[model samples]
Target: MPRIRKNPTGVDPQLLVKDAAKLMPAPTRRLFLRGGASLGALAFLTGCDIVDSASAEHVLMKISYFNDRAQAWLFNPNKLAPTYPDSAVRRPFPFNAYYPEEDAPEVDKEDYKLEVGGMVDNKKSWTLDELYALPQETQITRLICVEGWSAIGKWTGTPLREFLRRVGADTRAKYVWFRCAEGYSTSIDMPTALHPQTQMTFKFDGEILPRKYGFPMKVRMPTKLGFKNPKHVMEMAVTDKYLGGYWEDQGYNWFSGI
Candidate 1:
């Protein structure tokens, strides 16, 4: 008779599965669960032994990368996130950031210049007036956060695809990266960047974007989780390199889509 292999590290296999599952998106988690949560299966998937906590964590990280790929493959650029009417717009949209509202970076509109670089024909830096002069559009969309809360707000800005075209960006590039004045940075896939709804937002609710909401500009991607929407953007680059984001480096899934 074959003997069962007991966990040598005393860490409950079920607990390890639970921890890893928590980091996955709902649909992926359900699929994972349906596939079976056995430690042997996880070991097979990660190609590592589940003999210790460290190995267990490595397995989880591998699963996270798997989740990222799965979500990216399943994403549909043509599918638009739902939009709301003016009456549904949340009054006093809640302020959110890693820092306090008072600490939001105060950018001077006159001196601010958005530096553009990487895989583009036009590498020129753009001033506030130049950006604002571009044709703009508005959409009332919900900002869904990973922290379990959501808010609908009106955002007005230039479609990122049009802006990319105007800048002579290589549409075939793999990623579009953004750097913010507040030391926050993130990158998104080219497909999402070219999505019609993804905009370089300059105004919120028919007024200049408040300092609390990223004064000069913000990238409003209703298709992604709130944190994926970078605020106080100062620089942008089109690249094939995989430059990880602040949260993404901390183990959050890179291809986080709603």
Candidate 2:
């Protein structure tokens, strides 16, 4: 069984701020701390001037939002994550989720139908065969987990942008949200959704995606953390509404970009 990862918020506020600060590059970290953006300084920005748990949490969240914005601004939809040769791909990629491995959802492919809704010209549902018949693309990319480990895996699937275009999705929409078979849901910004490397993957390691790795389909996002790449995706929608993710609602950073 995979070890249960603790909630990021279980730590004290000062420690949380310091940990978040580490995510910044060394030079940026130095500048951020020197600019009075440290935890001691953040207490003043929250208008509380007190380091109470509630106020500290709020200040840390604001800084997280600033980090998200910075990452989004630096993201390049055209540039791709570095790919590895097949020989360099990780063997037996690690499995991760909020639950144990034995509890992974069992999808019924025979009866599976991908529901497409929201801002689109055609809200037609799709079958596994229909999705497979769409133009297929393949790439070898690393799946970087928030837990500080990463694995290189080859994936085969349709370009999400092409699939969205076929379904007449509103490309101008602000967000693309997905519902998974295992009750997991998440959303991504429009630009990231259309990124060249963002694929609606059906195969892993050159074979049909096993149930352990999101059978039926998964959104393989190399540019984002593993949790941001949801699995067993069953439904999708294009909308401007902000749908907080399962972890996001629990105070995990919403825009957890790589």
Candidate 3:
């Protein structure tokens, strides 16, 4: 996504609300919008087990009401998990590129290409259709952003392991690193790469990724934090050695386990 000056969700309250919100249960909505009614009830029920009832109540209520009622949610148990109920996570159709403004970068070609190489025998560049031609896998995953909000999304794409195998990756390829268009990057171990649910994701919410979410292509690390999911992916390489990824060099742990 281009770095637009205005807020991406939009300035209009209704439009902003629509873009950010996932439809949640009516009671949960009421409890949240009505401000402390439901939160108070939950606190009363769980207070005995909590460290400090008053402090706990403040935190619980805060998560649900903290942000614009849409955009994303939280449910970090280590923190206060603000979850969107399962029903709210339903996908109506595929996601699309969300350009923040009219001047955002336009995808110019039909064959957006991806380069797969490094420590593999069959280094090659694949066009969008070529990638789609590969065996595809689909999974619903949780998009956990670092800012403390999350959303569950259904994604369809080819498995990275499949790609590795096709490219003839050496057994010693212990980790994979990605370079994305957003000037952001991430890396993961081979074990995480081979996990059944992982993907070299192509489609999201049944649609292509939005720019703010990394249009064209983005890495989706379901069991990991959002920063690990690099958007606007350009290249990937398998390595036996640990070359610290983009985030790691900045101060984050290379092994950012979820």
Candidate 4:
């Protein structure tokens, strides 16, 4: 039997457990609550005595990793996210980012080029016109944010799978990593990268994507929470490496599928 140590002075063990639960993404939290998991159970499962915040954090991170794997395994690659009509699209879509809207990167479209690398046969950089020339599709899907707000918006872009095929990307690669002009970065599993609803978005609301909404280009994934959809995308790489994202590195789940 695993030994459970008493928590430090003034620290409520129950509160610690509740705090850990709150750190989990919504779906994971629901599953955790449904299972009736508790601090003692977590310590027993991890074989670690949670005597302090450090130990508690260690245990919670392990559970988070487990949740990530479970979500990824259960993800249905073929299932499409629900789409709405233009009438359902939110007017003046809310602008969101880590920084203020005025601070958004101002990308000059004429000089912008998307640099592609890694396991793709064509490591060529593509210009705006070139990307726009690709077969484009539009979807009015809900953008679910981890912060709990959601908005329906129309996005138009090349289907990511089609773009990957055009670039001769290795479909078997483990992950597709992206770099944004605003110093944000994120990665997604190959399955998510190939999802039909995942797009390399160039237009929003039938207009060239505005600076406030990731001008030039954004990797839009209706299947993922808003943070996972990188805007102002400048570069991408297909690789087997696990390049963690900005939020993910800070303890947010890596496989944040919705």
**In model 1, which range of ten residues has the least summed lDDT?**
1-10
lDDT of 3 at 163: 82
Q: Report the lDDT tens digits of candidate 3 across residue range 1-258.
A: 223233333334444343234433323432333344665676588775353345554565455334312212222213312334445564543232222233233343364677776788988887777877889766766676554666677667887778888888874777788875434457777766765556777777667665544556666657566667666677788887667655455444455545
lDDT of each: 0.84, 0.80, 0.59, 0.84
Q: Output the better candidate (1/3) by TM-score.
A: 1
For candidate 2, the per-residue lDDT at 179 reads 87
lDDT of each residue in 42-74, candidate 2, tens digit only? 766776555545555678778988887898899
Q: Which RMSD values do the candidates have, in order?
A: 12.4, 8.2, 11.7, 11.2
Candidate 4: how many backbone clashes?
0
| Better-scoring candidate (lDDT), 3 or 4 | 4
- N/CA/C clash count, model 3: 12
**Model 3 TM-score relative to the real fold:** 0.59
